[model samples]
Target: MRTNYEAHDIPYRRKKAAGWPGWNSAEEVHDCIQTLNGLLEPLEVASTADVCEIGCGAGNLTDTLADRGWSVTGVDVSNVAIHWARERCRQQNVTFLRGNICERELFAPASFDLIIDGLCLHCIIGEDRDRVISNLSYWLKPGGRIVVFTMCGEPKGKDRAGYDPKSRCAFSGDIAVRYFAKAEEIIDEFRKESLQCTFQQVVDPPNEQASLRALFEKPR
Candidate 1:
């Protein structure tokens, strides 16, 4: 299935050399891990739990979570990212795989207790996003949680370059990304799926970049 999201095809060497901001510095990586930990804390999960991170670039959070005693699985459509994640994490508790969320059949139903989508959802378009959400909902056990972080088009204006009015998706730049909807729209989507949205927070990046963080749960 050829799709407009072709950012994953960039050569591994280039990605390695470019060293995407999120994966390059330890401090930045630590901050993201800490943020995730803080977000998961309010969910009341057990100490020992299974966690899955969709589009876990280079497995930074996956490795961090595994070290904290959670069994972690990281998935990304980029084989380069998957390879780096596997090699970098190298821990018994962490597993890395290359898969696309649009293809729901790649994953088993009711398999994860916590699913995290860190800046990945926006990359998908119209039906693909819905399919991914439906698949995630189906793959989560009752009472499970799903957390998403993305650049929302609210207080912050839309990313004109990133958005494609025709496809209603983001383009494949050096790293392809899509513009996210307003908080209300996201909440509405969750409601449509009967998912209980628990929290929504706005995060300001170091350089004034902004993002939306949402936590939703499947009713038990």
Candidate 2:
């Protein structure tokens, strides 16, 4: 997974034109931004809230949070991605670190006021998904929230062609790359970590790909 992401980041850094794999625009982070905004009101997020964005590729959304006066920490396994992220968002309030989310020591327990999955969780497969969720919960403050953007349910079109139902993974040739978990399954996993699902939305566009956007809150 690490090597695969590192390879993807190099071309992205040089061209900065391909956007993301599934999306068309490089600035297509509006859904994440919008979901986060909705959570702020109900959760009463502080103006200078400390946020951590997991797999913050090129720091697109991380930069926006910093612009809002929030302190942001962006983490990605790809060093190339982290380097580009640091360059893209040079604000003092934003810091980019290269690290894998499955590592327990990537961040101290209760390190962030909120954690954004940044559409990275689905890229993780197997028991690692559980480990990553546990880490996300551990990293959050008592009353913190986690916002997730991920591929969920069934795939469509080309994605469906590559889908492996047994593992819930989408493959590129013989290599398994992405997981498309059921929304209920994901919420159940969060529940196991004692995080409550405050908001959930599944977007399955016609003949296109499907995605899940959700907000989970930790009890105070």
Candidate 3:
């Protein structure tokens, strides 16, 4: 199955660089990076921590994480995105891998101290959720933390046409599957898989950018 990236990567990358609406927003980019760093602060993420950033578009956030002194590995499904991310985040500690994060083999088992998902999880629903969480579980070292920002409010009706309230899974457009979760639902999704919820907060402002930022930890 092809993803939105496989279909629209070239166009998205161009629009992203051109500062087009819906595709380009420096404020959103800033929000993503700053929020991640803020989350890492509470976790006391050390300089030596091995960090993986999922859907690391253009390295806006990934480069910043590398600057924060961590060894950062940025993963993206788009070869085009990964190309720019590598160039954008040129650093001794930063590396870029082009592949699906849902595939466990993309990374070694128990290899990372932290995983950051900036608007990635919201796009994965149903069985794909299990694939993603399994990869996260496999790659994260014991006691490692995962910080994710996802859609938490009412699903955007236009994009979420076949959303099931009972399951909180939304199928958007032909190939897109999005998920929306309540705060409790967010905690429950991870707790069921032995990942403990450490922190959860709703970001309610900035209009269309409202999201839920949650942190989960793998047991040591």
Candidate 4:
């Protein structure tokens, strides 16, 4: 699938400059960590649970998960991001791979207990989104959880457009990033797929960006 940003340019510059650590502020990172922690609460799973983080930018969330004692596998399309994550994490249990989400062969099915999107899902567009969801569900173990955070909007429709100073471009550029669904929409979609979904809203510190958090479970 074609992405809005110049795959080589900004991703390369951003990767080299500060790696994935520069993607968001320390405060923003803290909020994401807290949000994931909250979602994992009811699961009551061991901290050693196997976790996979898709689009794990600089590995910030992956690092956080590792610190919490989870075995994490972080995947990203950018080679720079993967390299940065591998170098920064340096933990035996944390693995980083560069790959496309549309292809499920990269990782074994039913491999992870928890799969995290961390704002990456918004980047996928059109039929690619459906393929991604299908692959993710297929790869998850029964009763496994998938946690996602993204900009709020209706499910399966056009995304809202605006400039992002960080990326120095309008949302995903020409095509714009797809905002699949809001909290309610996410729940509905999961239900239709026979996956249980729990939704929540997370406001960044001082109420900056409003991100919708959804926790989905594969039926046992």
TM-scores of the candidates in the order shown: 0.84, 0.87, 0.85, 0.80
Task: Decide which is better by lDDT, 3 or 4.
Answer: 3
Per-residue accuracy of model 2 over 1-220 as CA lDDT, tens digit each: 3225445555565556554522224445676667556645566678879999898887877877788788889998877777778766789988889998989899999999989886788878778889999999999999999988787888777777677788778777666668889999999999999999998888888876777778998999
State each model's CA lDDT, in order.
0.73, 0.79, 0.76, 0.71
For candidate 3, what is the lDDT?
A: 0.76
Candidate 2 structure lDDT? 0.79
Model 3 lDDT at residue 70: 90
For lDDT, the strongest prediction is 2
User: What's the ranking of the predictions by TM-score, best on top?
Assistant: 2, 3, 1, 4
**Clash counts for all predictions:** 0, 0, 0, 2
Off by over 4 Å in 3: 1-5, 8-11, 16-24, 156-173
Weakest ten-residue segment in model 2 by summed lDDT: 18-27
Q: Compose the digit string of candidate 3's lDDT tens values, residues 1-220.
A: 2245454476557865786432237787777667777877777888889999887767787878888889999888877777777665689999988888777799999999999988877766667777788789889999998998777877653545777677666644555456776756767778877998888898776446458888999999
State the lDDT of candidate 4 residue by residue for 98-146, as single tens digits: 8888787978989989998888876675566677888888889998988
Which 10 residues in a row give candidate 4 its minimum summed lDDT? 152-161
Best to worst by lDDT, what's the order?
2, 3, 1, 4
**Model 1 spans with C-alpha error above 4 angstroms:** 19-27, 154-169, 172-177, 204-207
Better of 3 and 4 by TM-score: 3
